[model samples]
Target chain A: MIILNQSKLNPSNIQPSEITSREVFENRRHFLKAAGFGLAAGSALLLSRQSQAAIAPVTFKANSRQKISGFSKTAYGAGEKLTQYEDVTTYNNYYEFGTGKSDPAIQATLFKPRPWTISIEGQVKKAKTISIEDLLKLAPLEERIYRMRCVEAWSMVIPWVGLPLASLVKWAEPTGNAKYVEFISESDPQSMPGVRSPILDWPYTEGLRMDEATNPLTLLAVGLYGEYLPNQNGAPVRLVTPWKYGFKGGKAIVKIRFVDKMPLTTWYKAGPSEYGFYANVNPNVDHPRWTQSSEKPIGAGLFGGRIKTKMFNGYSEQVAHMYTGMDLNRNF
Target chain B: MKKQHIVFVKAAIWLFALLPLSRLIWLGVNDNLGANPIEFIEHSTGTWALVFLLITLSMTPIRLLTGQVWQIQLRRVLGLFMFFYACLHIITYVWLDFVFMWDELLIDVAKHPRILVGFAAFLLAIPLAATSNSYMIKRLKTNWKKLHQTVYLIAILAVVHFWMLVKKDLTEPIYYAVMLIVLLGIRVYFKYQPHLKSKVTKAM
Candidate 1:
């Protein structure tokens, strides 16, 4: 393990005001480059320990290889800055790679999401398997900045570019009997090591009520921040339900099934008492283990503080009419 | 035990104990604490606390198995480090996470069973950490042993606290729980070994 000598970390050299300045930090980056420790750029941002190996900074480029049209940047809700692409891609909770937040960022680099075929079956008029490329051809994509609130009470404002789920369901021509839409994620145990362990039932599944699926706010995201989805952030395709907790949005999905009954989601199946079916982002309804009243936005620093969590993640104005008569606390 | 050997062991323990804090400081200063730094700090400190507690608990069994009386000397260092990390964990949650809003914190403590259990575990660890010195052990005599027995309960509580905090994946907590159980099982086996041996002799 290469240890950067502590003597070289001169606090006086790095101006106190410039310590948090990203621009000034770039200067320090250049300085480290000149000093020949450029290789430790990522580790340099983190303090190096003698016992452990230095972690290489994860580097990924936004490859918007697919042409998406009719998608204008329509800003939505509270106008929080889109989380830094680096942070958004690196900081993930996709347990398919592993349970650790950073595990997906590192381990998912090798996952091949291309040549991916999704089987769209169940209660749809045209139940057939389709290639991801063919699905992309279904509708014009739109860039929607949606607030993704995790069940863990942290959140991110993500700039997602995708077609509306309503368009996909329209193409599938869902049967009148369809009450729910179930999503099954890709589960190759050889690639997705998390599948080797029963952290969750293998071939992760998540569901949305048919109306929720047809909601305009519900997006079948193909990219983020003008780039194709990073493997860690669910490459090729994923669901983005802006009004619900993040887990409701399954990643690396392989199957989209329109069903007659409320589908059993992976989390709700594992612990029904903890994770409810309609995992809506209701500040009034606290999770069994944690309060949902507030959320710390991702990329918020140590002193950068938390904000009051908005009901339905601030999309209540648009989607509140759907659950008019149901008790949110019970359904949550 | 040789004086020089004991000194070297003490130095090693101290250095090892300080590694997690040094790593945290490095991560904080470098601004490499990912998106949720408070959660990162809380988790890192909390994990280290359980790790140190497991290490400390293992010392008695190690001593019993190896017949190394000197193994007891390292227990204090590990126990103190466990308390130190637990303090950091609580401080981060209360100060940084909640900003010391005692009312909100209290309400949460009441509402969340995991938080309440974790708080109880931390509170129970206080007397054991406070009485971890040779002078206190000498003065308290048998009371010290009785008081320190709370460490086992604290270990169980810490594991449960972790198990409850996790959303779905119980793999990590399950691993910690198994480690704690094995460590305690070693002690129980040793405690009853002589009785089992005598019973075998009578049967023969």
Candidate 2:
């Protein structure tokens, strides 16, 4: 059992250096404002001039991400080089924003992750809606650096700060009838441009079996890189199951329903033949569109090529027992 | 068109056709190719190749509509540009993405329909690009037209390769598919409606 150190975790005691300098932050805002004016004046010139700038490496210093304090570091992904905070935040697959990898960073600027409430219902002993502020205080957050493998064959090592889902499950007090847990993400059409499109059904949903939810490796991520999550990286609260593909970590989640039966996840519903309910990181089971035997690390650069993928993304020791006697290829 | 005018136009085409490659190099040098540089390069080159393929296919249509013969002369350069970008795209995939891992590549080609179709499209473009020279065209004579006609097949395969690769949003691929269909459809319409063809010829 972990003991809470209230003083060490105080938000006000956060080191100033951990936060972006005010000058740089202000400059970035000014640059963005200038770019907006350029867009209004002559978009053609802006397009030609900023073509390369559009793909420039994003710096965390540009945005003043709130510093998350008091979380203790865990040995998750020890010795692994963490992917740059810029790449992890900028390159995302939050389909609610847009399909392009960089789209989330550009489009999610207006997304408001605060004042968010997750409704916990279904087979739980008592259904309740908890605000994001209340949820953060439920348990002591820990920074767990984990290998995040995407279904698209790219991977990242992210330092996620959050409490275990088991803690939340214990708090929810699920009844015996609860067999599965479904996560539903926010689908505000006004802020989320991708939701306006008919891509994969809005309010993206993902799920986990009852035991999987209670697993120690499953994290309810609220922050990354020692700061509150950037909007593009699923601000407020999101799920992070290190053993599964990154898609299993639903972003901007607003609902946690404990149900008796399996939930039809958004991706599974979109392409039943491609995505399966048990999206465990199985290297042997290739996605229908591409090979899953290898994955390119996000910050590996051009020549980094790809490294061989591992079973359960190298976390088989912890999560493989959950799938004992079951064929991963079928349940993949 | 006069000889000088045609030369000037050809030079402009050369400059315009090489812009995508130049832009890619500039981005690479500036380190602005985003988080996944290899994927960015692969996508940029592949999209340019498709754009050039569609442009090459449109030359005859442009001539048919405007009753101008000058645009037809640009087809060879346009087609070659398509092959050039396609080569870069494949090289990026093989050397950078796969790192010449022949065994994995073989498995990828065999297992994935998207890779197979894209590879087949590249292979088909080889013969067309090879026989594009004047000497080879003169030597092949009547058979040259038949060989070059396979460009239509290459375009179809390229479009299908893109369509298959996209995860869900088919908007971009659908645009390319529609463009290819319209280009091919124009020829089909002209073939079926000889009266319209004669009228176009009379106008020319």
Candidate 3:
């Protein structure tokens, strides 16, 4: 065990420049106490302009209405490297644009995500359709560092900017009967090529239990890495339930419905056996096709070592009570 | 065919087969291998394995139709390349993916049907690759022909492995499946049409 720890400490295994740089090294030391050394280095590396440019998100003409705010940051998944913006955008699982990881970035380049409208309806006391500008003005946006784990056994630490879904839910004034919230992404096949194929049922749908939707941790993210959200990263606005797998956070959302019962989700509807409705990040509950026991951190590059996946993506303390008295294995 | 042409074709096949590997090396060295490099390597090697298998599978039909007996001899080299890539794909998983965790790897293999099928395909290819040499071919004689036929099954298993791994958007895997079906279909059609085969052989 001592030898193993010593070997891991050796910087040769990782990039020499990262270990040798004074700023990165100092940041690692200061942040390592709070966050894992790897996660600290990963976040610090993301701030470097070179990596930022390399993983550049989709560029939209900056909208004046989108106000950017910096907050006292708290690290989630400390020691985990933030997935490069390039990979996060380019290596997307946005089936609406296409299936290939790189497809959405390319296909979504021409997609107009601005001037969007989202309708708040269903069991809510107030039903209103609002423009993207109106939605942006609804609340103050703050950055939350989250560990976004994909169902495919790959994970990333993303610094997301958005307001809590709870704030939006309260504004909508959900009725007492409201038990679930369903979100629908833009479904134009004329622009989104992947929607042309039956790979998934079109008009991608995702839902959250009302409590899960309104949890303090549930975010309706509008930006990432201090910039407006990239189109492929679900521009304008999208849900970010950090404890669940990334898919549960529906992208390019156009509709928000508060319902009395569970809603049909795209992946769950397509392959019920492979994708569960909850889609919580449970390491013990393996997908039918792959194991969830471990995940390859994005931006760790090809040769980087794997890390054991944490329960609820290491957010169990904040969200575990929600699943009390329930069996994840059966529900999963 | 002229000796020059045979040498040129051999060299071209070698170059074409090594292109994917060379590109991978370049990407790895340059740090251009995106977010999940292991996945990039695994997918690249796995794609090349299918490519080589498809090329090797196409060779028999090409030889039967064109009567290019020289191309028939190249099948062994192509088959070996396929086996080499399959080995790389498995190595990437065992070494890089699971990092020699025998227990985890074992459990994964048992649980994931795609991994099991992929492993079976690799295992089946080993004997055929091992016996690709002239000595084994000469020693085994008719048995060699029977054993070598396992390539068809291996190819099918390989495609199935890809098909299962992809959740939806079967476009990529379906392409391989169609190509393999057509290649296999040609053989079955030619076998039943012995008279037409003789005419084609005469023309060649």
Could you tell which candidate, 2 or 3, scores higher by lDDT? 2
- Model 1, A263-290: lDDT tens per residue? 8899998889889999999988888888
What are the C-alpha RMSDs, in order, of all predicted structures? 8.2, 8.8, 12.5
TM-score ranking from best candidate downward = 2, 3, 1
The alpha-carbon deviation from the true structure for residue A92 of candidate 1, after best TM-score superposition, in angstroms, is 1.3
lDDT of 3 by residue, A1-332 (tens): 11111122321112212223445545545775588777867776554533322232333335622446653344544565677766676677888877767557656756778789999999978798878877777777677889889999988889888888898888889899999999999988877877888888879999999889988999998888877887778887899998999999999999999999899999999989989899999989888878898888888765676789999999899999999999898887
Q: Which candidate number would show the highest lDDT if scored against the true structure?
A: 2
DockQ of structure 3: 0.20
TM-score of chain A of each: 0.81, 0.83, 0.78
Task: Score residue A283 of candidate 1 by CA lDDT.
Answer: 86
Residue-level lDDT of model 3, residues B1-204, one tens digit each, is: 778887898899889888778977887898866667798778878988988899899988987777766777688888889988899999999988878878778978999999999999999999998899999999999999999999899999999999999878775677789899999999999999999788778867
- C-alpha lDDT of residue A313 in model 2: 94
Error of 2 at A50 (Å): 11
Clashes of each: 1, 1, 6
Of the pair 1 and 2, which is ahead by lDDT?
Answer: 2
TM-score of model 2 (CA atoms): 0.90
